[model samples]
Target: METNLSATTAAEANPGTARDAAARHGALGTLALMIAHCAGMVDVVALPVWVGTLIGAYRLDPQQAGLLPTLFLAGAVVSSLFFSPRLNRLPSRVAATLGFCVAALVFFGLASTGRYPVMAALHAVAGIAAGCGLSFTHGTFGRSRNPHRLFAIAGLTLGFFAIAFLGITPGVIAVQGGQTLFRIFAGVMGVAAITSALAFPSLRPKRVAATPAEPRFDRAVWFGMAGVACMGLTQAMMFSFVQRIGLDRGFGFSAVTATLIALGFVNLFPAPIAGLLELRIPGRRVVLAGPLVQAALALVIAQSAAFAPYAAASSVLVAVMIFTHTFAFGMLARLDGTGRAVAATPAMLMTGAAIGPVLGGTLVKQYGYGSLGIAAALIAAMAVFCFSRLERRPN
Candidate 1:
């Protein structure tokens, strides 16, 4: 009797333990999504720093410098739209792991290649590989039980990483010169490639029946996509040539480094707060705030020539831009029950970013950075109008 009672009690406890283990597994999977995304997200900021090398080594003008990021983003757009959609038949682990590995190799190429054409080509290829990894990773994260919460966590993780990199990378670059950006990029990609195999949790469902049509792209979805692209354009305009602008103002290397570190630390809160606010505010309003803030940044950039004021403005801009970026995609998450839509969202962002660099660079080279301010102001107003229309339209 005693033995039977003990056996029965043990069996009852097994279910709870299983539940606990499953919860832990899911949390780990969410963390993996963050790590995977962070690996890609760092590339944008890296370009501004790397431009120093391109200009010095290749005798390239600012307009030509823009091509590198443009091509990189173009590759991301192509892979996300055409390649990743086709890769759904592959197991998530197989796709994500392979893509990460290939991308890592390309990053190594980026570190080693000194020529302009070779470096550009390598980054474009790396972008394609990154897109595939992102597709798989996004799908994996979207399947989490608390996707909104997970997104908040993702935002928080990115903010923290941004801050840490801002703090450390400037010092590294100071010591190692322009090549440090490439080396750091390679190291980050290599680390991600190794860790990614274990980062993604299985997205397979328990149902024997067919899965629901989640991640649907209705009219609302397309509108949100457009908005993301515009946001990307705005971001590229603001960040890509900023180093040149700072140099023109006579800001020293130390000043730039200190400002970036301060800015990064400040942006850490806005992402998480934006997520929390999305729970209360109309989603459109939350997103609209991003552009308005960006416009403010443009004004500050145009008016303030000093490093102190510029630093303050840019830091706030980074904070608000990231905060809004999280919510803009959150709209997609709300619509995309299947999570595939969210996977494609990053591609759409890349598409806009691809266009932004060349356009912004040309404008800056011809009309100057002040023209960028005007462009951003106009774009910000347009974004507000477009978002208003999107909000009024029903799902």
Candidate 2:
């Protein structure tokens, strides 16, 4: 009778324990998400310009310079597969905090390093950290209440952070050198990582209710992948050549920097607007249509005769791309309903993103900046084709 009573007591306590675990998970997830967004902005705005300048200083060819971005994406790809399963099994806060700590160290190393190879290696390490952090946060968010809303908020934050960081950091460093800029960014991320580690316990992990099994090869997944690829391609073209494109069109170096800053600023507003639209329209349509608009804008950019027209077209294209990509991510999580699946989506997206700059660089080497825009437009069109095929099938 005593043993039976003990067994019953233990069984009764399990539910409460599970709920407590869920609450802890959610808190870690939110904290992780914020850190990831901040880190992402810092990287997108600063890393590319820094790496590109480093490669140019070393007199490396376009292909050689392209390796930095490729390696970064490669790190992300490898880590995404490895990170998610491990994180899923660990305590969420512990996993997130550790990942951020690793990222902070890598950024500090990059800031201190002088050898090109070491810089590249540091970028790869940072990529791994980002991959792990993003996978954990995205996976956790997917299981939360109204995950789409949470994701949209995260996206908007990411955009604003990128605009703020990239807009100011690059120009500041443009007048200085890479080392100072990287150090500043390192300090910022270090503080963020530490704070995140401390504050991770307040939010709650969501208890995942059992749901129907998702299809293994859903059309929605493919569409989401295509949309992500298109967004990646657009970004690759813009970031890789925006400065050069401006200079070639007769803009001064200051004007080039200003143009980049303007693009970042433009990115800030569209994310919220896109998030709102995602709530009203089918995500498929938004994903499919965004690239088409971008393609049109790319064509205009390619054909523009003056700096004003080029900048105008470029800004519009960027704004549309950001909105579309943000919506695609939200839709991807909604469609897959699994952290692994959502994490896997970025792998496909990053593959395209990684390849895009290399392809754009090669096109520029062969033809020119005009060819780069044309190539991007063609890729965008291809994304539309893939999206259309997915749309014909029922959701």
Candidate 3:
């Protein structure tokens, strides 16, 4: 009799409870956004590895090699400003799917093209696609009811995709050659894009009721930009030069790549933890702490003679770096409280990413790899200063 009564009560509660659950899950809308983010990860993971090899194969100088990644980031920055806002007006699913398809095509073209100029152009196209993907995915997911969970899912998805590509791409290139790998990647991304397009919900655009626009040049935005810029510069430097650091330490190509891949693996698990941490701790504090930790690790790696210690330090550095940056993103979304504002965040981020490598490469030419640690430390200190100022401002 008691069991029957309990069942009846649960059944009576089902409709309201189920609706709440759906709201928490963000229905189908959140899944669509996650898929779009996963599609973008395919390129972000693969590009650094490819860039290193492409530079060697072309026998380009460091400056010339640096230009390739810079151009790619430049495209992202420009497209974010021009294309991202427009995507909000289009059907979200279609815009995201089309962007992924375009990126896949460009990736395939890049693999096929032998000439440096042609490859560079395709990379730029890929960057534009990346900008669109990032913009739309952030916009869609940020607006979801359960944004923190969605962001965590997005970060984990990106990290796993990165690890998979970093682990597999080199072996695939060795066994099947670059062209075949490109074809396989393109096909895979194409399928994902198509599936995302089909599975996404028909979302009615939310009306933005007119209000006084916030001042464009706010102190919060500038401080956020500085922190993001510092992180980007650090990442770009590490991405561009970590292999060289390994090689200089007498590690083999496979070992160097494996160490790099390990960083991505570490990244896979930390994002959700970072998201949870953001809820308990202040975002500025987390962001400030990350660079200090990274700088310390970089110094250890720079000075370490043994491969094991260097690899361990490097991996931890990257893991923490990603964790803090992902956390910062969540905080940015919280602060913005709108999809468009979140979409705009990447544009600010790309500016830092674009400049970091070029500057790092120049530094390398002038002072060599040993200077990288010191430079990173200084940049982190600057980020700390920027965040400190922002923290003092009245909300």
Q: Return the top candidate by TM-score.
A: 1
If ranked by TM-score, best first, what sequence of candidates would result? 1, 3, 2
Residue 124 C-alpha lDDT in model 3: 81
- Assess the local accuracy of residue 219 in candidate 3 as a C-alpha lDDT between 0 and 100: 64
Clashes of 3: 0
Off by over 4 Å in 1: 1-25, 56-59, 83-88, 205-216, 391-395
Query: Which pairs in model 2 have colliding backbones?
Result: 22-205, 23-204, 23-205, 25-205, 26-204, 26-205, 27-203, 27-204
lDDT of 3 by residue, 1-395 (tens): 00000112222233112112222323354565566676654434554555465555555666666767777777777877775454334565666677778877887777676777886787688778767766666665555555556677778877877777778776776566556555755765676577557655333332333222322435665677578778777767656766667776788888978887897888788777876665577666777788788778877776677899888987766567567767666655555543455565557666767776677677777887777788888888987877666543111
- Write candidate 1's Cα lDDT for 1-395 as tens digits: 00000112222233211111222235455566677777766654555565555665556787888888788778877877864443334466667667777887887777766787898898799888877777766655454445555667776787788777777776776676666676777677666666667656654322223322223367766777777777777777777766667776788767776776776787678767866776677777777777888888877875678887787876676677677777776677666544556667558678877877777779878988788888888878767765655644221
At residue 245, candidate 2 shows an lDDT of 65
Off by over 4 Å in 3: 1-31, 41-44, 84-88, 178-192, 201-203, 206-218, 391-395
**What is the TM-score of each predicted model, taking all chains together?**
0.86, 0.81, 0.83
Give the better candidate number (1 or 3) by TM-score: 1
Model 2 gets an lDDT of 0.61
- Ten residues in a row with the worst lDDT in model 2? 1-10
